[model samples]
Every structure is written in structure tokens, then in C-alpha cells.
Target: MRLPLISAFGLALFSLQQVAGITPPPGAESLTACSDVSVRKEIRSLSSDEWNTYKSAVEGAKGDRWIDWFGYLHERVSTKIHGNSEFFLYHRKFISDYEKILRGYEPNVVLPYWNNMIDYQNPAGSPILGEKYFGGNGVTDKCVSSGIANSWNFTYLGNECLQRNFGEADTIVTWYSPEFITSILQSSTTYADLRAGIENSLHGIVHLSIGGDMNTMHSPADPIFWLHHSNIDRLYAQWQAVEPDTRTYMYDGKDYAGNDVTLDDKLTYTSTPAYEVMRLGYGNMCYTYDTIQTANGDENALLSKRQRKCKPRPSKATQTIQKLPAKVLADFYPSFNKKKFSALENEMSDITPKQPMAADCSKPFTPPKPSEKMRGKMPYPGTLSKEYIKMMNLNSEEVRSAEKRAFAMIDELNAANYLSPYLFDLE
Candidate 1:
């Protein structure tokens, strides 16, 4: 028996629905999975209430099993996740898992991402690291004394306070620019290209720039780790949204063993397959960034009343076109000589007369000299300098060695079932 032929339009629609893993109900035009919608905002954008709630959730999670849970998982998975094809997907899953734990304590809590690009020129000066937010760099003994974890103590790693030592004093590390990230989003075709671009550049810089628990295997001990990863995840999600047809279920790259990575590959410590985590709004992945939702034109994603008012509205009046004086125009279009344009200039001169130029404006336009205060005494630690690049290279090798050790330790733990509490059979 012949099957009914599906129209090309119907087939395309069905395919898109399959890729997005969401189907609208009958009579519904566009449907967003309420549970799947995760609105991650910029750290600096969070309101006072939201920031306090987030801080409380992080503080509350300290003594919870979840703290050790993430710390141990990071220790075990750090080497395998980084510098591999699984870099983006693995971290996506990791951050989602972290957010779930945070929500267990504060149901309304959603981890706010740190768009490091906003602070790319002056990372140290960003308010996200101020005493009001995550706090600045560590002081004595490399211990953090302010922000969310100021008074919080950790028991998993020898009962020490969380730490964050900026790479250098009075020096702000340069970070990846939004334009650079946009290039990666546009140019990257396969999962590997995007993964490499992100893991090496923005990802590494943030960790190194933070330079404390963030630079270590158990970086999750630092709350900044989640925020940083959330931003990374946001970028990955944004990249996927740019071309959902191919990117949603796309998975290509190499695993730690140098074997080709497939969607079926299991994320470490979770029963969930990598493919499940690759797609947003599907399986264990039930969160979307505010940016992504806005891009998709989801009106519900606009949270606050202020945000609703900020929607693009049609202008009441057409923009009035101001015509330049004929004399001024003569300079631009020399073919229309000033002599020939004199009549037209006389006609409109009253309406478009030139104002007297500022005295300094006519001066050779000398730029203000760079002040000593504007110049750093030392190069940014995150700069791609020979020494810094070499350090990154060494760090990559160190990561591999750490991964090897972690795998061996994991094997021993598995034999004794020591990872039972930390391991989740995430679907």
C-alpha cells in the first residue's frame, strides 16, 4: 500500500518541530514549554531582590550535599570536558544540573550569567565583582572576604573560605569581545569549530582572569564558576539559535580518548546521553537564555513590566529629513562645484545655515594624550603574549594529566561505588 504524500511545507514544519523538540497544541500558533524556558539574565542586570535571592541560594547550598556533589563532579570531569569536543555540550549539561540544585533550595532562583564581554576592557572594574555582588579579588591567604561567599565556609576542601584572586593588582584582564564572539557564532559550522573557539578564548580567559578556585579543578567551589559557565552556555545556546535547523541536534567532536564524539556518548556522572543535552527545551535540557527567547520572538520571555514597556513601538511621526546646505554638499560632491551650487545654497541657507565651529574643533584634532593612569604598568595576564600563551599551553597539558588522574581515581571509586551519591541518572 502506498503511503500518503506529505507536502514539502508540512514536511519542513514537521522537521523544525522535531529539531526544536516542541510541538504546539492544536489551535495554538506558537507554544513555548513553560518548564523549558530558562531566562538567564546578566549578573549586573539582576535586581536587588533577585541578587539577594541568588546569593542566599548559593549560600544555602554550601552545607547541602549539592555543594560536594558539584565540587566532586568538577574534580572528576574537568579534564575530560575541557579541550575536547564535549566542551560545550558537557558544560551545558553541567550548568543545567547546577541550576537544578540551586532551584531545589530557592525555587524561584535561576542562575544569572556573567557576560564577561561587557567587562572585556576592564574586568576588574565591573560591578559584578564589587562588594555588592560576587565581591572583588581575595585578600590575605587568597581567601574571599566579600560578596555571596564572604562569610560562607566550605567543608569539602578543608573548610576554607571561597577565594578569588584577580590575576594582578590594579590591572584588569582583557576578555573576549562580543564582536569576536559574534564572528565565532557566524563562522563556526560544525560543533568542533565552535567548541574550540569558545573553550580556548573566552572560556580560558575568564577562569585565568578570576585566578583562584576558578583556575583549579574544583572551580565550581567558586560561585563565579556557575556564572561564567552560564554565560558560556548562553553563547552556545545563542549560536544554536542562529541556525536551529542544523545546530539543535548537532554533535561532532572528539572525546578525551581521541575517539569521535557522538550524541549517544554519556555525560560523566549522569545517565543522560550527550545528544539529549545538545538540544535545548528537550530531555534534561529545559532552559533557554533570555537573549535566545527574545531572538525567537517569545513575548512571554519579557519578564518585568519595565521590559514589556521597552518593546519596540512604531514611531508616531516619520523622521524628518534634514537637507544639508548646498555649500556643505559642494564639499562632498565636488562635481557640483561651489559656484554652480551658490543659487541652491542661497535658496536653503536660512533653514540649513552652518553654526560657527568650536575653536578647538578647527585645531588639528590632536587626540588627548594617554594619561599614565590610563596605562597599565604590566601586560594583562590574559593577553595572548608569548609567556601567557605558553602558560595556557602548559595549563592544557596539566588539564590532561589531571583528567588522567581523575579517571584512575574514578575507576577506583566506581569499584567501591563511592560516586553513588554524586551520580544522578538524569534522563
Candidate 2:
């Protein structure tokens, strides 16, 4: 499905986050100043006092505006700033600004919790976190009674921090996978299908009745999810450096489900303009990989070149050890295909592994019917037919038209400078 366009005001908000050094459209100069690294450093370093200060900023009548600002920033990064130059030169700057801001207050003040099911052997009790917040004792027996597990399903908390504290600054600890690494691996192999297969084989998480697999339920409530995603974003940046030609990951112009989906198709919302989703989403946007990191830690060189010198000495172990070069445990898993590594190696020897190319548009694009179970809740609102549209008190044509307008507005916004904070001078 094509994406919806944004409103003029939304476009303006998007422009403020851009910062490309290349010559953008008229008035794009404003976009060039938005993604300040200093801003990121400050957010990363935020201390209790700084948080309190920021809280005060939100506590005032206009405090909610800050939330809106973050929302806008998320949308800008997700949708606009298409292509690699924009991805590296602009989007990275915005994330850097956020990181700098976080680091500015307390560089060491890491997000304390990660997924909810980590070795709870010695579960650390917290006044704010734990079964108390969800109304259970910290013990496994009491955890379910509190409604902590599966409560914040699909929120960031599920992805990163495992504990929950209702509305307070509470945290939860849980076990989860790293999505960024999975994405990288999935790019080359059928990782998504494997993930589904694995989750299905396990019959999903032990107690959670939310999303069956860990991936579908990831949200921002868990603080660690952000850091994990940040690292994923860094990997995307790193990948861009190594595979300069592999900017877009779509093959056959269709999504994994074999439905026609362009990179921009993922950006649009059927009903609303989806500015908020854009700010936080980061799904569809033009971006090239950033300069690769060399073995010497230099940015902008070929990553493969660095990999050559850093190749490991072969071991005699029967099981192949896929080289997971990244530091994080999550990053390491997807690098080697455990199931098909032997076949993959043979293929790699004969052919240059190419990412899936876009769809062959010469053929007709057919519309498929939605499954029975997918009727009430479709990923995109527009996926349903006229019958579903009537149930929602809307016409399919009107929805389609609205979405068309939204997509146009988004493009205009990008062209105008809504993503200024992302761009930076390459020099």
C-alpha cells in the first residue's frame, strides 16, 4: 500500500530535524541545523537532577509539548531523509544528538534493567519495580498475580527492561533477543521465517499471552530496548559503510508476505497522516550506509577490508563458528547461519551474495484477500476491503485518497527540511 501524506504543519515540524550537507530544496537550510550531536550527548548523560529538570519542563502547562517534539522527531527519522547520504549524513546526527544528551548528564547511568525473564534466581527487589508495581511479590509464583508479565506487551519495556512499575519510573528485567542483529542476518538469509519457526516450535514465551514471538511485542517501555535499537541503528550505519550498494532490503517490491510493498509503502498510515509513527518508527526512509569502520577504528573505510586482517585462526571444532564480530551477544548470533552455513559458504564461493532486489514490475500486481483471523486487526488499516471499510464508518476510496494526501505531504516535508537535524557537513 502507498503511504499517506502529511499536513503542511507536520511537514514543517519534520523539517526542523534534518541536517544534510548536500544542497536540499529551498529552505532546507533550516533542516541542516536540527540533528545536533550536543543535544544527543546531553540526553545520554541526563542525571536524576537533569531528569528532574526535564520533568519540570514537562510538568508545566507546555510540558506535553516536549513529548510532541519527540514524537515529531521520531516521524522525521522514520519517513523522510531517504537514501544513504541522508541516512548517514543526517539521521545519524539526530541519534547522536539524543545520545549526547543522554550521556551529558551521566555517562555511566545505563538503563538498569533488560528483558523480564533474565536469571531471576536472585531477583533484585526494588520499591518501584517488581511484582509490587504489578501487584505481585517479586517471586516467580507471585509475578503473574501482579499482572507485570504480558502487561506491557509490545512496549519497549518488553524488548529491553523487563520490570514494570505502572506509571512510575519502575523497571522490569526479562530475556529477549536483539532485533537489529536479526535484521542484518535476515537480510541475507530467511531469518524471519526461521524466527517464526523457532517461536512456533517453542510455543511462544513461557507465560506471556501477548505476542507469540519476542519480536512482535517490542516497545519503548523497556529502557534497554532503546539502547539495543540504538546499537542496531549503529549497525545499520556500519552496514551502510561496508555494503554501499545495499541501501534498500526489499525484494520483488513485496514484503515478506509477498504483498507489494515499497520502502515508502511502509511509511504511510491508512487513516491518519502518521506523523507520530514517523517520529518513532524509522521503518521507511531513504538512506545509504555510513562510512565503514576499519580495523584501526577509522570510520569511512571498507569494513570487509578491516575484516580481512582481523580474520580468525581456524579451529578444528566440528561445529562451524560463524564469526560474530560485534561486541553485543545479540549482535553475534545472526552473523552465521547455523542451519545452512555449509550451503551458504558453497554459494558464496560461486556467487557474490546480493541482497534481494526490488520486484519485477513488468508483471501485474494482484490484490490478495485478507485472512479470516486478520479481519478485525490488520497491520495497515487499509488492508481490508469495502466491507471492512463500511464497518469502520468510512469509504475505501476516501481512505485511499486521504492516504494519498498524507504521502504527498510527507514527501513535501522531507523536501522542505523537516529533517534538518539529521544532516551534517561531511567535511
Candidate 3:
């Protein structure tokens, strides 16, 4: 069955764009210099006061229907920004605009991103999905019963309760890992490559896995939308910081019409020039992600790189112990094979390593090399079909290529037996 990557309610809202004017568009309102910068951090890292401050502001916006308004506006404009060069620039502006609204309630309030890469293995069980956070999957006909958005109702495209429908037998499939994302960040030297790498992988997977409103173009109706996009923006900013001299202003790629993109490209709904948002610490773009923040005077590196290295060392037992065999891994690690592999050890999936491979510390770990079998299986929800490609103006060939690279990263991590930094160890 062909999946509908586009929203079910994509009714154009040319007028709805006028509602989110916390920061005015480049054409009409004169730009103001930002004296203070808001720091966007991971949601789990927020302090009590910080979390409450953000929550209160979000609640205020939802009460005033700004959340639904953003949803409707996105419903109208998703196609233009997605699957092209404008993906990064447009969302940078769109998310910052929402942040301004939240700041209207509390000036100090900043948007918090969910470092979703760590939770790839079991997104359903992540703490961010608990009632204390965004709540978990819906019960009673897929209606969310917990989280800040549990009782939230929306009037955009008719009233409906907030929802999240996980994929693959009612559970969210595995997401892209940090190692994979880091590879994309490190390896992608151009804007177009970076755009393809992200848009085709975790960016789409999270939206699909958290189905319902999240599955649609009108996804801003759900609170997770902001956090997810915030993380996306964080990645972009981190990429820019990689080489501050050249990449900070780098914007190249084809648009939906197959024309080369430029820094002057106008964002569809807001009519803002793309260059206005190319950099993150000035004008309307005045926020820096925690990961992109400087560490010990290193101004041009991501904090993730500055503080920690991506290469994980195996435990003594791991080096001496055997590695998992391909078939045994397929049976135990459903994520390796998605739906096709038999879930024979479903009960002990995370904990039990059935038939461990012999530890061969002598052999050098191989870089991510996705085999033909690995390339064939991806998150079922992460499908960008031909119809979706046409709707989003995505290049079909580029999509296939991007998926291969993403899958290759997955294969590499599996081959290395990389334990997710996000998962907890129970002894």
C-alpha cells in the first residue's frame, strides 16, 4: 500500500500565516537586533524552574490556539519547505517564530529539543513519552491519556484530540542512531547532502512513528512537533558550526521545480528571505542549541564533539566475548531486519544476547557497511513513496541514495555492536 506522507488536511491557509507574527516577516516589518540569545537544550536536561517556565508558556499558547494555528499554517506550507534546500532555512524561521510566542508569556523561556537519537532502540519506552512529559501511545481508540497534551483539543480542520499512533504492530520502529547521525554530520560537506541525509532518515521516521496528528502536514498541533523540529534545527546549526568560515552561510540544493536554490529564496508562507535566517545568533534567528554552544573557547565545534568522542570502546568481556552472528542478531534484534525477520526472541529482545559471537578484539572494527540484506530493511514507517516524492518535490533518486547511506550507517553500528548511548544499563 502506498503511504500518504503528506497531511490528510492540507487545506491551504494563506490567511493563517498572518496569525504567527511574533516576529514579523522580512518584507513588511523592519528587523530588530536581538540583544539576548536563547539557548535551546535537550528536554531531559531542563531544570525544574526551566521546565515549568517552558510548560507554562506552551500552555498559554495552546490556550490561545496558537498551537492549532501553527498546525493549520504548516498544513498549508509543509510541501514548500520539505524535500528541498528550504528545509533547513524555512524550519529555522518557523520554529523561532513559535519560540517568540512562547517567550511572549515568559521572555526567558526557550524551546527544548528531545535528543531522539539515543532513544532510537525503544522510542516507546523513552521517558519523554511518559505522562510527566509528552505522554505515551493512546489507549481507548488511540486517544492520549497522559502528558501535557493529553486533554488538548484543536479546532483547526475540525476539533480532534491529540493522538500518537506508533508504527509496526502498534509500536514505534527503531529510529536513526547518534552514530549514524554523527556520520551524516561529519561526512556531509555540502548543504544538499546534509539536507538529503536528514530529511530522508530520522526526520521522517520520528514523524511517522508518532502517528496521528504527527503523521500529517498539520503536525504542529502536537507539542512534539516543536521539540522534534528543534532537534532538527540543532543538527543543522551543528553542521554549520563544523566549518564556521565556509558552511555557516552555505545554502545550495534544488527546489521543488528542480531549479538550484539560493540564499535569496523566499519562504513560501512568511515571504521571508532565506538569507535572513542563514546564521543563528543575529536578527530574528537568535537562538543556539546546547550542542552547538561553545565549549572552552572552541567557537566552531559542536559541544557533542568537543566534550565526548563518538568512538565507543567495548568492555573487556565484550572484546574477549564473541560477537553476535548475523542470523542470531536478526532474530534477537528486530530493528536489524524490521518486519521481515522472525521475532523469535521477542521476550528477551533487549536484554538477552542469544548465541553471542566470539570476541575478536584483534580484528579492527569495520566502518558502517550496510549489506544488501541490511539495505533492504528500514523502518516501515519511514517510507517516502512516489506520491510523496511528487508532492514534496523530492527527487526520487536522491531519496533512494539517502536511504542507502542511512541504512549503511545502521549496518555499521550493528557490525560494531554499538550500544546506544541513550539506553540505560541494568546490572
Please report, as a residue range, the 10-residue window in candidate 1 with the lowest summed lDDT: 349-358
Give per-residue CA lDDT, model 3, range 1-427, as digits (tens): 1101112121112112212223333442344434555567677645456677888999999999999889989888877788888898888888989998988988778888887875666688777888778888877667788988877888875677888787666567777765456556655779998899888877877887788788788889889999999988888877665555567667788886679987667887666787688766556776665544432132233222412332223222222112445553343333333432111111111211111121123432332222234321333225555655665556788778777766655555456554433334322
- Give the winner by TM-score: 3
What C-alpha lDDT do the candidate models reach, one value each?
Answer: 0.57, 0.27, 0.63
Q: Sort the candidates on TM-score, descending order.
A: 3, 1, 2
Scored by lDDT, the top model is 3
TM-score of each: 0.67, 0.30, 0.72
Model 2 sits at a Cα RMSD from the real structure of 20.1
> Which ranges of candidate 2 are over 4 A from the true structure?
1-174, 177-244, 248-258, 270-427
Off by over 4 Å in 3: 1-33, 168-170, 294-393, 416-427
lDDT of 1 by residue, 35-72 (tens): 33446766654555776777778877876757766877
**For model 2, what is the C-alpha lDDT against the true structure?**
0.27
Residue 215, candidate 3: C-alpha displacement in angstroms: 0.5
- The weakest ten consecutive residues by lDDT in model 3 span 1-10
